[model samples]
Target: MTTAAMRVPVTRGYRFEWVKLVSQWRIRLVVLACWVAPALFVAGVSQQATLPVDTLFGRWMHATAWAGPLVLLGFAGQWALPLLTSLVAGDVFAAEDRLGTWRHLLVAVRSPRRIFVAKALASLTVILLMVTGLFVSSTAGGLLAVGDRPLVGLDGHLLATGDAAGRVALAWLCALAPTLALAGIGLLGSVALGRSPMGLLLPAVFALAIELAQMLPLPVAVRLALPGYNWNGLFTSPMQLRSVLISVVAGLIWALTATALAYLIFVRRDFTNLNHDGSARRAVLAGALPLIALGAATVVVLAVAGLGAGSGIGQDKVQRSLATAFAHLYRVQTGQLNRPDVTEAQLGASAACTRGGGQTDPEGPGNDWRCVVSWRLPDTTAVGSAIYQLDITPDGRFVADGDGPKEVNGYFLVRTPAGDAPNPLWQFDGTVELLPKG
Candidate 1:
């Protein structure tokens, strides 16, 4: 056979792989589930009497159309994302092994490299579609549940409908990196293990393990470097470029490494040694395979840790975040009270914050920070000042609780004209900036 005839274009194999993939009823079902399940979850959450305040935006399901996707993003990172990626990418190569069709595929393509490329591209395309389906369905569900009101963002800014939609969409787009990272691990399993079930199982286990590791009392740099944690940065107000970059860089490195290893293994396999019945395949570096995966994950974490180390946490940033959030939420509080014409500008909110009797520098995460908040009400010369206790985290999130019992800040319900409503000042969520100074 001519050399030209032996080397087929990857595009042909790509199309063939895609058709083979979509032809499966299971693939179609997975896509449908991605679209249907999130909407159902949002609908259910909306109807529940109690809100899920533990999640970032879960308490606001009835307040805005952006919360559903944000909630789903949090939920998925725990387990759904790994499972979602593995369902397809994990099985892409292993399915052929289980069906005893490797020999047939090799005969058709004659180039394992091209075949691997085709399958990888096909699986990734499907996974991308699945992610998109989730994004769209979640957003649709939020709209149905909440009727598209302005979103009070993490920073306490009131985001208009279009603006909230834009940020939520961008956040969803940013999720693609972690999805790809987990997918890489799945693909590695599919290629190395040659069992559809193992391929599917490994990535889910990887995700759970990552989540468990995050719970340890590890240093902030190490926690930030963990594979899926960077999703938090994507939703931060004004965007944390360093965190986003870490997510992308870590994901790309891990993905490319795993894919490259898989490609190398796939291309070098001696297909001519298949049994007569095409089922007696010896193990493919069984022990070394897992070691390789573990080593790759470890290396990526270390490299990414250095990147997160420079993202300084200090006093000024936290103060700015808390003060701004206080201003924004103060307006919300007044509006809830049926106070007329009370605007953020008119409120003139400001705060003076300190750490641990001025003994500790106002830097880093702590539970002992205090802030004295003061804001002017419309048509009032008196300045109302109240102390706020702050609990700050390395990720730039802060929960500021109102100090005085009479002051209505912290996670509490307040009386409004519409009836009992959430107090914007109570246990309010806000963010400090994490970008490294230029």
Candidate 2:
């Protein structure tokens, strides 16, 4: 008797794997966790807005309007994503050994390549679902709690409401790129370290280690290669396209290399000896330690460089400029010069004249004159204080003294004929430059 020809199409393998994966309860649990966690976090933030305290936290929360959603993505990528991917990817080959079904499957399906492709596709689908769920949940929560108001950036600049929302969306999308790299690494780990906790925990640990290393003050070249840099654009006001592009390229390299290595090892290794073997433990640690060390060293070098840079002169200049500019602008906007009171004695013994409000000037064009201004709060609970000085230049221009921390020095263009209807002498116009020490 001749047996009927038996032919199982290659496409059937993927369908079979997907059907098996969807039937598993583990995937459902992970999907639920990804969706629920961010929803609850958003609810908690909304409740916190009603508390009676300083608005510092409130302001910070408003600024980071997209943080909750992004953080949910980060958290899942760190642990949950890896663990879930491993459920299918890790067990792809090993489960056959555990169930003593590998030989049977080998005989029945007659193709290991088809089985591998099917399982990989199934894992990829789950990751896509989780990422989508995180983005939707986060956007909903942020809008509900924060309102669609304009965003105030960390630098104190304002962003229009529409621009802020668009940037936020871009930021979320940028964050996902690194997450995909992480998922690829997890897939590699699951396949290589089959049926062991190392398959699950090692990738998560590696991701955290990379993050810590990037925090160090390393060379710009090395930092560009690390995955952590991929998210830096998210924090920048107008996203730095160059930096983001470099990070994306580096992530792609790492993902491809890792996946290739995992596939090479899994396809060649014998799975029949699957048992509690110390050899597998050694292999896992031996492979992971060097990468961890490299990441750690990068962090240390970068951190030291950052500390050596001191308090950052550019930042200091920006802050002082902003403070001075805002003060003057507010005065201009309000149309009032509310000078505080200073005593004649506080102006120094060389004072030529003293006004009731503590304003003072020295006798000659070359003298250094100092004045102190003080005012009591209406409630009498606190007192406001300031000091101003005048330095007479050889050019006959009365330069307002700003050499000391208490003084703001600048050239004052006084009116030649003193007080008039629109007192020209009383009008002060020129740049108010802060001294280096101040």
Per-residue CA lDDT of candidate 2, range 88-202, in tens? 4545544554556655665566655555666667766676777677777766776777666655332223457677667666755665556556656666666666555666665
Instruction: For residue 262, give model 1's deviation from the true position in Å.
Output: 1.7
Question: What lDDT score is found at residue 387 in candidate 2?
Answer: 42
Model 2 segments more than 4 A misplaced: 1-11, 50-67, 71-97, 235-237, 271-438
The whole-model lDDT of each prediction reads 0.74, 0.48
Looking at model 1, report the run of 10 residues with the lowest lDDT sum.
275-284
Question: What would the per-residue lDDT of candidate 1 be over residues 1-438, giving only the tens digit for each residue?
Answer: 885588768999999999998889989998898989888888779778887877777778877778889889888777778887878888888888777798888878878889999999999999888888888998888888778888887767788888888888877777777678788878777876775466667778878987786554444455555566455554445656776666666666667766776777677766676432211232235323644565456656654645345335677777777777888777788778976756667777777788998888777777899988788887789888878898776666677888765646634788887898877777666776665554
Q: Give the winner by lDDT.
A: 1
TM-score for each of the candidates: 0.83, 0.59
Candidate 1 residue 225 C-alpha distance from true site, Å? 4.2
